[model samples]
Target: MVKGEVCSEGLGPCDDTCNSKCTSKYPNGKGSCDSISNSCKCFYQCLQPKPEICNVGIGTCSTACNDQCCNGNCAAKFPGAYEGHGVCYNVGPSIYNYCVCIFKC
Candidate 1:
């Protein structure tokens, strides 16, 4: 679950108006008005797992080679995992020299 705050308008005390605004914004979320901040605190379930990163450090390779390496490393690190992939990035003065694995947490 995640908690987020949204600004509330009007010069009156915090009331059900904040709840209505939050509910309209996030139908699946619950909200409450905070008197201290005059904002709406919303709590909702996370829709997706956060992405995990694995840096393979500096390396020299082509896009295809980097993709293969990242995929292999990510697979080794997260075996039997579903819904994950790898990406190749350039770093420093060299281009296409970094491997990063982005996978589901």
Candidate 2:
């Protein structure tokens, strides 16, 4: 669990007004707080709707999708993930701030 930073390194604002939520970069996230802004970044990986964890060597990716979005088990299938079948597919660059997977089935 990440604890939001209360101190602002003397830049200013140390009161309740300065209270912010922790931010995370990865989905199925496995890291710590990313204090970039005020909104609490949803650590998708920690919750669900996990993002792509690519197996670069195999040119394939895998993850579990959000149950609310699809009726299926937490998937670990290949890319081209399909709903009701448990799979997720991704495309584009490797340095995405967020992954927008397309599911079919």
Best by TM-score: 1
What would the per-residue lDDT of candidate 1 be over residues 1-105, giving only the tens digit for each residue?
111212222323566676666567657656676555565665443344443322333345575566777767656654555333555655444553666544443
lDDT of 1 at 40: 62
Cα lDDT tens digits for candidate 2, 1-105: 112211111123233422232222332332222343322323322222433332111123333333322323322332234321322333334322222322322
Tell me the lDDT of candidate 1.
0.49
Candidate with maximal lDDT: 1
* lDDT, model 2, position 91: 34
Which 10 successive residues of model 2 have the least lDDT summed? 1-10
Q: lDDT per prediction?
A: 0.49, 0.27
- Output the lDDT of residue 58, model 2: 18
Q: Residue 104 in model 1: shift from native, Å?
A: 1.0
